[model samples]
Target: MIHDQTLDQATESSKAKKAVLYRMVMDKHTCPWGLKSKYLLERLGYEVEDHWLTTREQVDAFKARHGVTTTPQTFIGGKRIGGHSDLRTHFGLRLQDPKATSYRPVLAVFATGAGLALAASWAAFDTPFTLRAAEWFVSMTMMLLAMLKLQDVEQFSTMFLGYDLLAKRFVPYAYAYPVLEWTAGALMTAHALPWLSIPIGLAIGGIGGLSVFYAVYIQKRELKCACVGGSGAVPLGFVSLTENLFMVAMALWMLARMI
Candidate 1:
């Protein structure tokens, strides 16, 4: 009797591995996310029943019938498992908080800028790199960050006021901050006008470091960092502080070399 019961339970478990995925795959454009969902399901050992909607009308009809706004909808044991991200959550794979702030945008900008600097260094000076390469990397990163802020200066300024002591006191400083950073970065990269670039870097970096420390550590405020842009999803923490410290270090280094 016990052996028969175990066999029945195993059979039920095997049956539960069956899944259905309804997705859009039209001629003009097949949904990339839909393909991702199908791949995820198959990789997880599910026997997927793939239903492809080949026309826009068919896609619309399917969505309407299912009362869902988006496709690649999944069903497991006759239960809706939602989209790709949702499916990952169901499998305990995705642990990200949807509302939590991230430093990805800033990190990406720094990474790409650093790569560009290294490439420039290799092309100009050849092998073994140098301290100058590090300087170039920092300068280029600053320029990129400034450009991101310049995309929507008004929005950036609004977010900037949250933690920047100068911005909070003098609204115009917030508006002018991106331009100052850009000018400093451009001059530093070109190794031109050290007088202007060094001062700007030191002033901004010093003020920024102090403000970030006070807001993030002293006050312990959980606010968004405006480092990358005005989106305000980047958390105010180590990454933000590090950017300022890098600026300060670079400025000091340049000053010492000049002296």
Candidate 2:
């Protein structure tokens, strides 16, 4: 992502050229998802200009000014590309096809384990026999989540790969969903609140929905994602919706089963 000042300079310089300007309102650390998105786009050969906006007020202002809501909000050719998740599907769908092997399973397993761990911790420590074991569990879960993400070789590849617009856009959104799973799981574990994970899962599912929504728009226009790093045939739009819907169902089931 280009610095705000640098973006301004480039925009001014490109006044005579047909250059597309993009912006992302995100925090650097907590929203590591945004960073991954930026990485994907850059990897896919797109020039992206990013800006940070932390508060809901800031997000609102961007939406009011640009007429949209969602984080990692993006604008291209002076048009809204929607938010981070939207862009992720946009780029992924543009790719060729899914490889025979995928890291998605690893991610799913990690998430399930984290969730079950939290449930176990809650059941065990619910009584007064434990000494702040909940806190310890929470911390450990958080660490595990971070470690799980870091363990993915694909993430490291996505991070260090050359900059592509599709890649830059997709990486953040793709990486974010999994991270959210872990974070929500960790938070639920920490509080020993299994019910909360349902909402959190639903929220993550919503992100997938957003991506699918945008993908349909892209497909209707017949534009392919340029962001796929080496992965081919990115599934756009409604595919994301299907995935999200499945996630929502799974989360609901998990909640019911656990309770």
Best by TM-score: 1
Global lDDT scores for all candidate models: 0.85, 0.50
Write model 1 residue lDDT over 137-244, tens digit each, in one string. 999999999999999999999989989999899999999998999999999999999999999999998898999999999999988888888864898888888888
Please, what are the lDDT tens digits per residue for candidate 2 over residues 1-259? 3345544544454353221333444454345556665665554456776676666676678678776654556565676666556665554433323454344543454455456556665777775334344333433433453454445636533532232233345666545544555666565445456567668667666654554455455435332221222232333334334445655665565576676
Model 2, residue 146: displacement in angstroms?
A: 11
Badly placed stretches (over 4 Å) of model 1 are 1-17
Candidate 1 backbone clash number: 0
Per-candidate TM equals 0.83, 0.29
Off by over 4 Å in 2: 1-176, 183-192, 217-232, 237-239, 255-259
